[model samples]
Target chain A: MPTAIEQELRPVAPSKLSLRHVSKIFRGQSGETLAIDDISLDVSEGEFVCLAGPSGCGKSTILNLIAGLEELTSGEALLDGAPITGPGRDRMVMFQEAALFPWLDALGNVLFGLKLKPNLNNAERREVARFYLRLVGLEKQENANIHELSGGMRQRVALARSLAPNPRILLMDEPFSALDTLTRETLYRDLQSIFSKRRKTIVFVTHNIREAVCLGDRIVLLSSHPGRVREIFTVNLPRPRDINDAAVATFAHQITETLTQYLETPATKEAVL
Target chain B: MKRNLLTLLTFAAVLAALEVAGRNGAWDTRVLPLPSEVAAYIADAFTDGARRDQLPAAVTANATAATLGTATSTTAASLWTAFAGSTLTEALLVTLKRLVSGYLIGFLAGIPLGLLTARFNFFRETFGLVALGMQGLPSVCWVPLALIWFRPTENAILFVVVMGTVWSLMLATEHGVRTVPPLYVRAARTMGSRGLHLWWRVLLPAALPAVIGGMKQSWAFAWRSLMAAEIYVTILTGCGLGWLLHNGREVLRMDQVMGVMLIIVIVGLTADRILFAPAENRIRARWGLDKN
Candidate 1:
């Protein structure tokens, strides 16, 4: 471990987050269950990668591992050439539920994420928090209570909160899954805009193949039950791509078909639904 | 507003009916005094300090105490003075003071105790189990134990009141902290919040609605336990409202008894409305549990 003074003096390099043969096995009351198999993937700096598969695919578990919210059973998950043993400021995870504190207002929730930046004074932090809120199109709802906000609005605030800290890597576990179609579409556009504006490595998890196609620069498909990397699809689409665009739909369809075919094989045959 | 007026009108009509029934001897006035007479008795208790001849002997004797003593006065001199006489107003104030003090101390102390219960296994097995088991017993059961421990001093009443409050508050806090959704903690921790920051900033606020609920219930428990203690340990605890009620019963002053009962109900309602109502409403609104 580097000394505190050495850490401060050394300019931190933005190396890619690398997962080398990472595996996670959960010990429950019933027995030990393997959640993830040996999965080696490197998310480059400022890359938008989506982990896409069915429910039991351990896509979320992958995000948790990357965020250092879960311990690896085997192999190493590295950030900036350092092993990730636990959660830190550089890695922020946004859950499916907005998870915004009901006790706080919209800006208050964003300001809470800003608490990680100890050097920033109250006024500067407020300014930074407000900027992110405006980025997510919630500039006017700064003082609005979390409970007062609609479900879509709440998610927007959660997005703002996660982005406010300006983490090096954003690990999102199906943050928009619970939202309606229209809201999710709007959020996809907003998220794309934010991702481009604030360049950061993002590992997004989603079951929606279309959502993965619309958002991710590269989509990593994983097989269900002891999730392992199935295939990689690189989206060669233009910036700010629309989810309803024909090109996006075609890519989504292709990925879904390939995934279904692999899962339907006799040796590993399993029901998709 | 319309509903409130309807309730007020209904309450007033019931009081008026009771007044007429007692006046006509239909309800036996001696057994249960008219509402107007009870109100008059309460008024007399307040203003009849100078006119010794007209006032009830008990009222004059009690009210004749030099002045209202402080709530925490456990010194021998204060005890002697309190034993001499304590008025209806003094009794009410003393009870209120004990309820507020005992509950505050217990509630504050229980927050950490309850945190222990929810956070660690050893505490959960030992202290949490004790709190859970003790909660099942009625609060009045503490009065005898407190009397044996501290005698008829103010400590005995306060001890009972604290006993009534602490366990309930502890259990409530434990439940609140334990039931906080795991997502909130995960979100905060992933953002680099841990240890005490995690406890106060994330965990405590998340557990607040339940803690507020504990405060409300703890207030009621404290009030009840204080009353029970006052009834038995009546020597120098400044003759609390419970003592006044018991005294009225002994003297067959039905009006005084009902008057004290009315004050007790008023105090309960006032605490609920003034202290808890707005707080509960605000929390409900902020938490998205409110109807409108």
Candidate 2:
């Protein structure tokens, strides 16, 4: 095993996102509701971490907090030792809905991400956009308008757009959940390949256990009703894991069993009640 | 293609029925002239000799006398200019110019005001009620105040037109900006867009469909207001399409009146069909906003 001093002397990975005892409380007419309980998570550089749980678990809330879309009610979310105050291009988010600008075609949508990189001229930007479009296997549909693309194609365009910025951290909020099972499986493979090649710190939020088991290096199970981390499982499965593979299903089943046990626990039971 | 042909046929049928009605004396000639007679009268107004002959005797005398005060007399040498200026086409050009200018001014002012109102709660609370109130108040209602303030000039007409369309434009802009899906804004923000850049890239484009819809409505209001302004303010000058209608009615030239009315209808339809509709369709097609 590599010694701690050897690791310290080694070239550090670029992105290491840390959420230190983060909590979120939303106050409305119904009164104060704890959306996220105190939860701490550390995602090392180039690691694929998935927040997996059922709905109302604040999995998306945590993702949003990490993305700097919403401020933490307590504690801090840090990127490379600095607390995240607001949204930045360094942390690009891919939403479940594909949230693409309808007015922009596929190439245009991808180019939109390059807008932040002011150093690139128009030609350079176009080249970069084309590169990402091809990476997402959407080179042919570059000129196709948002409405012209199917749901899977739209998501691919969105993925291209998010990746075009070449952010240090990619925060995905159930990106493949909206697609059909077949498309989702294909995207799972593509996403795994992209992850291996790109080597970026990614925080993916998904309720699907199989998805989390297949894609994530580590799965962070969040319990519902004032979401808190229930269990953390390190998937020892090999790279480019198939969602339908027995190993993936076994890990998924194990995570699900742990999640159900956590749900049956007194604290979560009372919260649900 | 079939729809357009059907529309043309229906229009021709209406014109034929009207011509037959007039020829059969279903109504007195004084009440309504034959469509062909109106068409001929409009054509004659454009023709050189017939236009020269149509000038009043006193105006003709003034042109020959070359009085110092007769600065704008219809002299024989400048006969076409005078005739053209008074004809439906010339009136149309003047009216369209005013309508476009006034509508543009309102549109420019309205978009910023709408953006401000939509973005800020304070502006929305204060100006929102005023915009709603202005929408209820007709453009014609502003004419009286405009006349007193601008003294029956082009300014007065412009004032009325602006008042007519500005509120609608502002309201449309406000609604458009406000209704931009939170998702798009949030998405833009995550992409490191902020301030004016965000507004230009995300907010403005997001609100375009609504803004265009507003502009179409604004054009209609501005066009109507211009007609009202010309008829009322240019009682003495008789400068535009509205003035032509007023002059025809005053002189009991029923053919000229009918001809001007037809021009007005044509202008209105052309603005909607030829200009606004195509623009709207293009945007809808690009954005996939419209259903097949």
Candidate 3:
């Protein structure tokens, strides 16, 4: 109700981010392949949107486009009403692979993200990097080598790195898919806590339906093979929704049923979880 | 601990068998000298006043003085007598200085060239083709050109050493940059890394493993080329291990030849273990590129 009141008050506010009729075609030796087609989306400031679908749904491709890693074949990607021509620290990306530089320790890896920040001296940068590491519950492990950290810990370090730049938007591409179930659940709770504290607009890509239900303010369901917007589901469930909560399951079931109407693939069957 | 013991035991067994063969006359001592005799020759290097002396090579009037105007036989004579009175250790120092200097130059020059070769088509078509083509030529083949251009001075030796190693360094660096994981690059790019920052922070580190591999091979080539240069173009008053080996051969002293060969093998292994192994291990461990 407060969010509704806030939205009503800011009725004329421009969208924080928008993808206007975006399309992408990849040309390989096999010839032209349409990656995604005519996908339009608008994400308000501080909103958590999840793009969910099966493999080859171009969920990652869309994230890549938003991150300015890939060029769109057609249409516009705008941020705060301005066209996004390239990548910047304002929209940082977290890949599935933590992608930490091996030569650096955990703190050093986070510091690397702050290399472009010209104002801060070396000491200030270390302090900032340390602060972010503390935020991710990795303060004790800052000196740990990249390979020494667990897979979950590695992602946590990556999350700290992406956050350290203080980006306006965070693009995460299945950042937790490779983690174990328990780790994913724990990260969900931690993420929700972090999301509440630092209200950055987030676009998360995932194949996990319940995960989408738990984390997203709105889930943007995508269809595969030249990905298109299938539907959008809003989760009005209360704050810090647990993945195993009965309400979360009901919402997940509801979304799966909607997906079943269009997709009979094995991916829809996977949507139940 | 156990593996090291096994290696030592195996080596001793080989040495023992060779010693027995020499006593039984399995092969002529002239062609294949006795292991014991070779050991004696090495010991002789320690005790012989002339062998142990680090004095400057005797520049007698009769000794062949090599200038560019002379023939190959005269050059061979100059090389043979270059370290006749000086200690083998002095020759060793000369070889090592050339090897270190050449490898260092190649490293400094090759990194940027390799990066350029990988990134730009301009370099790939021009320098890249040259590097690849040069790989086919043996390091010794460059000696003739090096001698003509630099006239058998220290510069000529250094030139041969650089030419021998630079091509491998170039190819390795290019290959290293080209094969860096796309994900790492993409990840860096998304973090607002571009241009020189990206190259220095991401691309260079990612390419390190491959570059290090190239370094190992180039080091071996450096030693090979230094020897070739020392043996062929020895107009310099100072000598290297190659010149020492040539000296032994010219005298037809098989024991001295075998003794110097033993020193070469020991030096080669030491370089690999002492200079390169720890670096390779550290990179592999830190980068998670190890087989574990």
Q: Which candidate is the best by lDDT?
A: 2
- Clash number by candidate, in order: 0, 0, 0
Residue pairs with backbone overlap in model 3:
none
Sorted into a CAPRI-style docking class, model 1 comes out as: medium
List the candidates ranked by lDDT, beginning with the highest: 2, 1, 3
- Cα-based lDDT at residue B172, candidate 2: 96
Predicted model with the maximum DockQ:
1
The TM-score of candidate 3's chain A against the true chain A comes to 0.91
Poorest stretch of ten by lDDT in candidate 1 chain B: B63-72
Question: For each candidate, C-alpha RMSD in Å?
Answer: 6.1, 6.3, 7.8
List TM-scores of chain B, every candidate.
0.86, 0.85, 0.85
Name the runs in model 3 displaced over 4 angstroms: A1-15, A265-273, B20-27, B46-86
Candidate 1 lDDT over residue span A93-151, tens digit each: 88999999988999999999786687677877888788878988999999999878888
Better of 1 and 2 by lDDT: 2
